[model samples]
Target: MSMGTKQAALDGVGRCSRSRPQRQSGVALLATLILVLALTLILGNIFYRHQIDVSQATGSLHGDQAMLLAISAESWARDLLASDNDDPEVDHFGEDWAQAIPLLPVDGGTIVGCLVDLESRVNINNFSSYTDTSLRAERSANANNMGLVKLWENLLQNMGFVVDESRVSVIVDWLDKGDELIGPAGAEQSDYSGFNPPRFPANTYIADTAELAAMAGYSLAEVQRLMPLMSALPGPTTININSAPEPVLMALSGDLGIDFVDMVLDNRPFLTLQEFYQAIDIRLMVGEPALAIRWPAKLIDVKSDFFQLNLEVTLGQSRLEVKSIMQRGESGRPAVIRREITVVPAGVTTVPSRSIDTDDENAADFSGSGRDRFSDPDEYDREYYLRPICEIADSYTTGDLDDSGEQF
Candidate 1:
């Protein structure tokens, strides 16, 4: 009986030991599974953050590359202007400097650039009354002082935009030192104070054309239309006959018509004032009554000193646009007066092509003969003011230089 009892007790103790070990193993396995799952979650979060950081860094790099490309294009434009300085007699669309840059392939991107003559357009600052006695005297003496206002009116009308005479007067008031209101079209501090967010008239000269939008009554659409035909240069500058658009040419004188503008453009890049006069005489002999009036030689010139360069660059998924105003010095080298940079979305395919079709029905009928001359030109050909950069490159490669220092 003692032996049987001892054996049963030993068996019971063995069973208890085995059962405890099995329970301990199950607990250890559950803990291990929980630890593994926690570690996986932590690692996954870290990996996701790392991927995000890498993507942002790549995008930043692309943006930097795009900016550099735009800056490089501006430099190239300066060089082109410098080259034109050698023969400063004329600035015309036919010249190499007026050519637009085509899409050029670069490292991880493409670039497009173009140069526009600021002097070709009317200077808004021409109305400003500066402390310079010489400038003041010129403003009073030159008939073009009023002529500029007329020119702006003509340009707006030609573009199918209703000219706001009051707005125009306000611009004139802004320029003149005197506080006297310019008839019904002018504005002063009183007019601006009436706004909910009270604003004041800029009594001084404007630096940017966009500032015109801030005027009391001007619309954004109207300002945008005027931007291409107007500039805000520091001082009074003569319009470059060679580069001036047909509308601007007509605005030079109310007597000047579309036919006269076409004649001037057809025989462009006039080497001297005498040459321009000779052309006018020829038009006069042909019974063009508009040509009978004396051209305002003092208010116009054959060359330009100020130009604007627009550059667009794409790098990977990033795009950048740069606009720079360059002023040509006596040495012919252009100095950057202003520069603006903007970032656009990646993969934007709005890069302007080599040739832009004038299919837009809204385009202004430049010819004022009450007919859409742009559709079909009989006597006057509306020439392309901006040529493709590829064409200019080809001209250079082929050494196709004409008497006017331009490629045909």
Candidate 2:
């Protein structure tokens, strides 16, 4: 009994020891599997975050590159304008500056730029009494005001805007220093106060063409239509005949019909005012006696001093646009007066090819043209520059005085 019992007990103890080790081995295998899964999840999270960081970094780099390219393009344009001949008189599409810069390849990007003569368009600020100090003392017949009014009326009519003549008076009244109403159609501070928002008339030179939308009776669409044909500079400026649009040319005189306008535009780059006059037949213009009576040679010139440069740069999926206002100084070098930048999303084209043929029947048709002449303020970059209305008015107020005591 003692021998059998001892042998059985020893065998049971050995089996129990071996079975315990097997159970421990199974537990170890399970723990190893859990550790491997946890490591895989952590590594996956880190990889995903790394990928996001890389993508963000890439986008930022592209944006910086696009902006740099745009700045470079603007500098190039300024240089080109500075290098122009000393003749401050003639700005024409035929000039090298008017030509669009070809798509130039840069470090992982492409850039294009073009220059436009701001003086080619009628300056609405010319109507501001603040620009004419004489109007501040007393309201009287002003030749400059009269000429600008006539041109504004003509431009509105030609653009298919059938506005009342009184609308022009209202705009002038808003600009004139006198609080007195200009005419039956004129508006003053009281009229603007009646608006839902109670907007006050500027009573000063307009800082931007967009300010025209604030006119009491005009719609935003109507104001926008006029934007392409008008500008609001610090002072009165003569129209550049070489760069003037056909509508502006026609507005110069009623007798200058579409044919005459087309003729002048077709034969552009007129070296001098005499060359421009010699090219046109004055006899045809006589058909409208008013044209012969009010030949606007004084209101027009062959050259331009203010210009706008539009540049676009594309780098990878990023796009940027820059608009710059340049004024030629006495030193013959153009100085940048204003600059604005815009960032566009991927796959969007910001710069369009320059169109030299103003005669294209569809050229002035802004509807469905797929081009936006007005740059949205929201799209402007952090460095956007806009002259304040007070600053512009002050500039005119301090300018040289003419014999009539008006600011020149």
Candidate 3:
């Protein structure tokens, strides 16, 4: 109650208030730190799970894209080997094949493909057939190798490209020569060059134009120009005049006393080659025209009723690799048997080739426009066959398919 007692009580009350507030502040600070740590742990877990989900989804998409493209490739190949028609010439798209992402209507999916040509495709079985001098030599020499080369060369030359001749010769040597030698520029694996990869001595026989990249001096550009004009077919020497070109015919006339290059070019797709041959400038060259000169049947004008295809496809977050071999039976009906190798973890797979159903006739939804290829009898057939099928494709092929005529 006294003045001194009142002052002391006020001081004690002030001290008590300060101590209680300080204690509360310390507890609040500790709670805030713990809350921050808990929030950080939760956010980290959520982000990590989200990242895993994104990765899985990405892989799945890639796998699907790869597969669809593969199927597309097989269809293109079958169309290639369907029929030897003069029309719808496979000049563009190189060999009636396409790659990269393409949209399919059914599944509304995108796919990348590598369409292959089974006819132009080399048979690993015939790898060494070029080396058989006796079996293939006489025929090779007798046929119009000159015209064939010229047509192929002209295709490249006209396209404004210059090729390495010596290196090309090495390719020919590799394909035809029986004996093997260390190819030109034989170096260790580390020293080869072509892209970032060191590629040397392409010893393996080429089964298709795609393999041309493996050959020395044969750039992708050069091969692209030559692909439509050539095939990795039965090594019968001559090229069919029906499918041969003016440049090739000119070369033929230069070599043999057949000045029919212009005639052949001027009027091609003749019903019979003999009709075109009759128009040759027989009197232009003074030498005796060898009437009995029987040419070997090195080249045969043919259309394969059956064809096979190999497809490599890639789709977004998914992958499907198909080694599909479509057999174009009689009437050019395709019977596709796919060897599918899929790479999607959870995507649904549909393999339609194994079954025979009305709806499944084209379950793959493959396309067909026009087709052509090479054909040779297992044994040498003396019968000379030179005739092209009816022109079926309106946009891509030509009726006159030649620079050299297959004269045997």
Q: Each candidate's TM vs. the true structure?
A: 0.74, 0.71, 0.47
Q: Give the alpha carbon lDDT tens digit for every residue of 1-408 in model 1.
A: 699999999999999998998999999999999999999999999999999999889999998878877887888888888955446667777778877888799988889877888888889888664333443353355453325556667667665566665646667776676567756657777777765456666777888887876675665546644666688987789888887765577666455455666677678778876677678778566432333234555467888889888887888888887879999777778999899887877654453343354423223323221112223444354443433333333333333323222222
lDDT assessment of candidate 2: 0.66
lDDT of 2 by residue, 67-133 (tens): 8777777777777777464456667766678676787998788886667778888888776643334
Q: Is candidate 1 or candidate 3 better by lDDT?
A: 1
Give Cα-based local distance difference scores for all models. 0.68, 0.66, 0.42
lDDT of 3 by residue, 252-355 (tens): 45344334555555555444444444444353333223311322123322222223343334344454545454544455546674353635444644442223
Model 2 spans with C-alpha error above 4 angstroms: 1-34, 83-86, 130-146, 173-181, 188-190, 193-200, 278-281, 284-293, 349-408
Cα lDDT of candidate 3 equals: 0.42
Error of 1 at 8 (Å): 9.0
